[model samples]
Target: MDILSLAKSVGSRVEAPLTDLRTVTKVLGNPHMPLLLALSKGFVEPVYRAAFLASAASSGVLHALAVRPCDLESLAERLRIADEDRPRLKEWLDMGIRLGDLTKREGCYKLRSLPAKALAQPGNDAIAAALEEVLRFHVPALLNAPRMLREGRRFSLDDQDGLVIARSTRVVQPLVEEAIARTLDRDAPVRLLEVGCGSGAYVRYAAELNPRLSALAVDLQQDVADSAAANMAEWGLTDRVETRQADLRTLDAQPQFDLVTLHNNIYYFPEAERVDALRRAHDLLAPGGRLLLTTSCKGGNIGLEALNLWFTYADFGGPLPQADELVDQLRQAGFDDVEATRIVPGEQFHAFTGTSKRVAYA
Candidate 1:
């Protein structure tokens, strides 16, 4: 079982006092967990409650509770109850408790710990705020997919700029930079290519690390290319990193990069297209060049299969491939060597770091 499954297996038994302190300590100390907790505190829980209510109501369990453990009357009063509804209040309270959202102890109702944690962030409040925007755009957009399919319309991510900003720089860049920094050869000038370089975050970071680094940033959209160029300019790296608008599937550049990276845009391609894209990425490398790819994989509390399926709404056709499959694909594309590593693991997302085989230039 994965780390998350282990946590779930033990999470219930590990609750409070014994585990709560440990859990909070882990959250406080972990680089990723704090951001997650803050997101949970600020946004995830509220949206989840809304989703839960909708899901439960759709399941027809919205209005039935009697003699709840917590004083339903007081809770209802706090939420603004009517005088007439007070007579049947206890029933409503019992129903809510049974529904697993609230806990009732000694005739008092309170939100459950897990749900309470949904909005109980301490430090990383910005993460929560960003997550709210993500869910606001993603959840309904995915849930409404069936209607879209019937209408023969494709879903678009134009409104997900917040998500793009949150993950690209806020999450992926630091991890990528750290991982790459560990593996880079300090004395040699590295030739880098960043595919789908939305805003040149990777290019700028990589350039900062190696002054002799030369990078090419490619994106299909002119706006994205321009944004990347602007970013590179801000870092005074215009001479070192050049931005170009080009499609990865049809890239015509000479194969000469030491590090070729495809950031978060790997999943947008169809299965066949993904294979072709990977093949193209492999073809672009100088013999020993590394092809680094990152994508979300199945992992934690968040349902991976469900999230993958949700992408279908947007006509996103390829679910992330397993690490083994990806490694095999690299070999088939004529890459000399390949290895995969799980760089980051989230409740629902896992990032894979794929390194290509180093070959001698003929």
Candidate 2:
């Protein structure tokens, strides 16, 4: 199938136009890729990491010496470990230093900016703890991908409904948060539309943060749409956000929103379908309205070897556009000032913004 070529093709077209991830028209949603997303980041790993780190701290005296600017000798002395344990501790120190969670100058270690603050705060060793536990989970899922394919069995991380959860953490949450922070005026109302809203996580976060903001969450799955509805109600945002099960290809009834969002959900369709969906989103925008898109290309953090190959074996039916190609498509679709930014440094996900061409009402 020339899997690599196929994956590369799919990754290219899935970026900008097919940003709405609600539809799964092909083998792109194979359980492997998304499973990696879930384990790498989520409440699932964070909660477990917290517990593991807490236990490691109590028994291992290194916690006391992990403070900023602490020397290796001092750290070793604080641990007071048996000679055999030194190698393990050195390896741990080496990993932490590399991940940017810790800094090493000369022979001393210091916390990185974010973790430094978390560590300084009272009763907050959360960062270190979470990192420890999540690593354990990530390793197993990564190694088991080949086994699942060979055995013709589902991966353990696959959702019961057979969807592979995002292999990446809701890492985009922070990006959206930053966007909201910059665009929102204090105490001013905002309206957001998530075109391929899944489970309402983004909407929920938006509603919770900006009491004055309203949201429209749309997904293709009736069950997921219902779940988002229930969540809005549970979160007391029923009056603020509405959930709907509508296909993006046929969505034509909604009012233009202040902002439209498409998370890392594209790539299930062929080239033509992707472009058509993008045109629809472009047409739906009001004057000065912005559309935000998120997608991963071949250059993204998680390797999509399986996904990249699926395009060839599955019959693309159309050619997929890469990052530059998608941007050009957005411009051609009549969107103005199309721009893209890397939401996470060295990560696959990217954020793009385009404004509808403002037409004068004569």
In order, the Cα lDDT scores of the candidates are 0.61, 0.59
Q: Deviation in angstroms for 231 in model 1?
A: 1.1
Candidate 1 yields a Cα-based lDDT of 0.61
lDDT of 2 by residue, 1-362 (tens): 45433444455567567654664335367656455445444544454444434334433433544444676566667678576787777777666554455567777776664644354443543333334324443344455656756766442212212111321224345765665554443476767878767657777776767788887788776776777688778878888887898777787555467777777555545666676777777777767777777666554433343333333222322222367777877787777998867666775555667888866475
Q: How does model 2 score by TM-score?
A: 0.52
Model 2 spans > 4 angstroms off: 1-172, 179-188, 305-321, 360-362
Error of 2 at 89 (Å): 37
